[model samples]
Target: MSLVRKFMTVGGATLGSRIFGFARETLMAAALGTGPMADVFYAAFRFPNLFRRLFAEGAFNAAFVPLFSKEIEANGTDGAKRFSEEVFGVLFTVLLLITIVMELSMPLLVRFVIAPGFADDVEKSSLTVRMAMVMFPYLMCMSLTAMMSGMLNSLHHFFAAAVAPIFLNVVMIGALFYALYTGADPLTTAWYLSWGVLVAGILQLAVVYFGVIHAGMSIGLKFPRFTPNVKRLLILAVPAAITGGITQINQLIGQAIASAQEGAISALQYADRIYQLPLGVVGIAVGVVLLPELSRALKGGNLREAGNLQNRSIEFVLFLTIPAAFALWILSDEIIRVLYERGAFHAQNTAVVASILAIYGIGLPAFVLIKALQPGFYAREDTKMPMRFSAIAVTVNCALAITLFPHFGAPGIAVAEATAGWISTVLLFVTLLRRGHLAWDWALARRAALLVVAAAIMGGVLYYLRGVFAASLASGSPLLTKLGALGLLIGVSMIVYFAVAFLIGGADLGMIRRNMKRKASVEPPPPADL
Candidate 1:
């Protein structure tokens, strides 16, 4: 299959997950709002979620896939299977120890690392500690699931790993439905959500485990050993972990800082969920598919193919994300009001969340671009450089969040995250170019500039339409009226952007068909040493 086809396959599954994630967040808004319980739950959840990103999605896959692909190419399927089992044994053992330690230290973590702002509030801190303990085990399940996902992606089996996330949203949505049906209090509902997260992790792991098996790769358990391959993995993974989870690390810091305010943490989270749809679908699909493909291209000694893959992935990401960013920024208020301005989620909360969402929109392409760019280094087993760049980004994020949060509140944190993302993206791009690893695709550069213009044009249309449908999007409007208005706005914006993009030579069916029909364009073989 073509690169674009693989991206779509993974992206389509991710779209399902993101859609369910929207449902889950909507239910959560109605049930929890920005109340104390909402703050407690989100704060608790961010800790485990941060670790999950670092270990499962970020570090493991970045380090594992390339190495695993090399093993397959050099030593065949048996060699890869043995290597997987070795890593799994070590990973499982380490996770067990970490979970035990974390559960024991949950209170101290909440008081210090997770939410120092909750320290003075005895009740909130205690609740956060308990809830965090319940959810922290989720890190173990998800990390294991990530390992299996790496295996699946290497084997060109993208569906299961991509689809597995849907269960997390589905199970949580089910929990929310139950809480709503029972009219449970926020505290009880928060409890339900925490347990729901744990259950979902297990289910997700099971899903991917079966997927690995179906792909004809059976990995059996073994005792932990510090084998040479495992040692090499650790060397690569330690840095990749930091680089991979840079966004999460920044968000965790923001969460800690935001926890000082009453509703800041919850507000940032709601806004984050809004923008994550595009980021997850476009950014993640590109990252997941591009990394392994680049690894294979490089392994086969095809430099030009690797360069084309990088350029096209960036092109694909920008083509989708630029317009998405504009739509979100323009429709932020309307989207928040239509989705969350009911029950406990008041109009005041909508205003705050919408502003944050708009700022997040500004950074969407940067965030996704980081995804498209990072594989250039990871595919070559060069994890340390990205890790150094991530440190700079994180430092920038910390400084900005501290300076801005006091002045502008939650939206300030959004600004910091976006700025940091763009900085990291530029660093990666420039470094890759300087190292002669990434070639400048002038066609991609020109089209990206045009796509931005198309998005700006669409943004103007959305701005006018929002005023036209202001009444329908108002808090007092009926739910159906709000839904219809928002749907029409989105539908019209998509049409306008795509039409403008195609007509103005930004992108066309020809470009897309070429991408979808393209295969690895192999050039000269590498030197024997390489």
Candidate 2:
């Protein structure tokens, strides 16, 4: 399959997951709104998610895939399986220890790290602690799941790993539906959601575990030994972990700050969920496929192929994400209202969330670009530079969020996050260019500039159409009417963006076809003769 097709396979699955995520969040908005319970639940949930992103997904995606691919190249499937077993054993043992410690320290973690804002609110803080303890073990399940996913991706089995996340959204949606049907109060609903998260984690792990088995790898437990290879993996992973989860780390910090205000955490989270659709679909798909593809290309010493991969990936990101960013920015109010302004979610909540969503839109491209660019360093096993960049970005985020939150409220932190994102992206792109790892493509540059113009045109059209359709999107509108109006706005925006882009020579269908048809030279060659 072509590289673009591989991306589509993963992206398509992610789109499904994100769609389910929208449903889950919509139900959540109706059930909990931006109330205290919403704040408590999201705050508790973000802690385990932070660790999963910071450790499991980040470390394994940046470190394990490359190493596993090398193992396949040098020693074949048998050797790769052995390596996976060793890593799995060690990962399992360590995760168990971490979970135990975190559970015991739940109170301090909730009071200080997760939501210091909740510290004074005895009820909120206590609920956050209890719920966090319930969900923290999810970290262990998902970490193990990430390792298996890395194995599957290295073996060129992308569907299983890519599809696994849908289960989490599905299970949670089920929980939400059950809660609503029973007319459960927000506190009871929050507890149900916490347990649902843990259950979903287990289900996700099972799905990927079977996927690994089906992909012709039967990994098993072994004694947890820090072999020379394991030690090397850690050396690479420790830095990659920090570099990979920079966004999450920044958001966790923002969450801590946002927690100081009631409903701020949930508002940020609602806005986050809206933008995450594009980020998850485009950014995540690129990161997952690019790292392994780049690793194989570099390992085979195909510098030209590696450069083409990087350039084309950026082109793809710009083409999709720029328009998406514009749509999110221009249609934020309509989108939020259509999706969440129902039940307990008020128009006032919609206004705040929409403002935050618009700022996130400004950073969406940068966020996706960061994902596209990082694989350049990770494929070469140069993780520390990105870690250093992450530190700078986090520091910038912290400083700005602190300075702005007192005056601007929740949207202030969104600005900080967006500014930090662009800064991080520039650092990654420039470093890669200076090192001659990322070649400047005139085509990419021209198209990126034009794509922005096309997106601007789309944004203008959306701005006008939104005003025309104002009554349909207003709070008192029927659910179907709101959905129809929002869908029409989005559909028209897509048509305008694509037509304008193609007409202006910003994007070419021919180029897209070629990319989809282009065969990648990144597949592992046969094992070297022993």
Candidate 3:
């Protein structure tokens, strides 16, 4: 597939997953609300999900993908298969051991690591511990799934791996429906969601495994062995893992701080669901597809090509993310009201969540820019710098969150997190610039400036339109009217932004159209014999 095609495939799948995620989260809000149960269930879910992201999505994949991609390019499919199987066996054994230990120590883990705020309430604490134990095995399942995804991504099979996350949303939504129909109590509902997470993990792993096997790559377990290759993988993976886990680690820190305030955890989560729509689709799609492409360019000694690739990736991230950040910042309240201010969710809950969502918007561009820039390090097997950047950012987050939390509550956590994100982004940019790995040409710089101006114009238009529709978006308005008003604002804002951008030469439909077709128009070279 062409690069743009690969990105769109993954982006399209992620957009699907995010839509399902909205459904799942909306149902969660209706069923649980911003109550103790909502806090408890999200807290329990966060524990296992933390490790799942750390091991699977964050560290291992960063370490694994480049190596796997290199293996594919160097030794063909057979060599890559041998390497993958060895890593899988060792990974499975280690994960199994960790899961057993954590499951056995569930209460202590929950008390100290996951959610200490719950310890004051015996009922809540016990429930969280139980649910955490039931869900802890998901770490093992998802870690395996991550490895499979890396393997498939290396083989250029992006669709199956990217779409796998929809499994979690689907299963969780179904569980919520079952809870509603059965008239389950809050704690019972939490149990259903917890088990749904584990089931989803297992199913997602199976889905990716099927993709690998169907590709005629049979991967059977071997005895755990740290071959030279395995040792090298670990050496690279450890820091990359830490670097990859920064976002989750900071999130855990935020939750730990938020847990002290009743309903604060749920507020953050509800806002996060909305924030992930842009970050997951545009930012993640670019980040994932760029690494392998950069690795190939650098490996072939194509520095100019790598520079151009990085430039385009950054442009794409900002092109999409900047406008999203502006809209999220401007219309967070209306968006929250239209989507979530119903059922068990109240106007007060919408206020807090909207504020947090707006704060998160401040970091949106930085978050995606970090994603775009980090591949400069990862593709070079220089994961340690990103780890250092993460370390600094996490320290900043903890310090700021603690200092700010006393008066501001959840918004304090959001502010701290966004600040830390910018710090990391700045550190990455400086490092890349110092190494002469990335630079901005005048056209790139000019366009970026113009895009910011266009976003401001769009934001102004949104504010004006919002005032005109203020009555329709009021708390007591009918759901359909609120939805229609919000939809109208969004449509007009997008139209204004693109039209202004095109007129000002910040963006060109012609260029985008050409770029999209550029990949499809080129014919592939015929395969060669060795």
Error of 3 at 256 (Å): 0.9
For candidate 1, what is the TM-score?
Answer: 0.99
How big is the positional error of residue 262 in model 3, measured in Å on the Cα after superposition? Answer: 0.5
Per-model TM-score, in order, reads 0.99, 0.98, 0.96
Mark the regions of model 3 whose C-alpha exceeds 4 Å error after superposition. 509-530
Ranking by lDDT: 1, 2, 3
TM-score of 2: 0.98
lDDT tens digits, residue span 1-530, model 2:
88899889899999999999999999999999999999999999999999998779999999999999999988999999999989998999999999999999999999889999998899999999999999999999999999999998888899999999999999999999999999999999999899999999999999999999999999899999998778889999999998888989999999999999999999999999999999999999999999999998888877778988998899889999999998988889989999999899999999999999999999999999999999999999888999999999999999999999999999999999999999999999999999999988887799899999999999999999999999998889999999999999989999999999999999998778757876554545557789
> Across residues 1-530, which tens digit of lDDT does each residue of candidate 3 receive?
65667778889999999999999988888888899999988898888888887777876667888888888878988999999999999999999999999889999977887788887999888988888888889999999999988888777788888999999999999999999999998778888999999999899999999989877687898999999888888888888878887888898999988889999999999999999999999878887888878877776666777787787788788788888999999999999988898778999999999999999998999988887898899989898999999999999999999999999999999999999999999999888988999975788788899999999999999989989999999999998999899989999999999999999989987557634653322223445568
**Could you give candidate 1's per-residue lDDT for residues 155-237 as a string of tens digits?**
99999999999999999999999999999999999999999999999999999999999999998989999999999999999
Ranking by TM-score: 1, 2, 3
Q: Name the lDDT value of residue 32 in candidate 3.
A: 88
Per-candidate Cα RMSD to the true structure, in Å, reads 1.1, 2.2, 3.2
Error of 3 at 144 (Å): 0.6
- In model 1, which runs have C-alpha deviations exceeding 4 angstroms? 527-530
- lDDT values, one for every candidate: 0.94, 0.93, 0.88
448 Cα displacement, candidate 3 (Å): 0.7
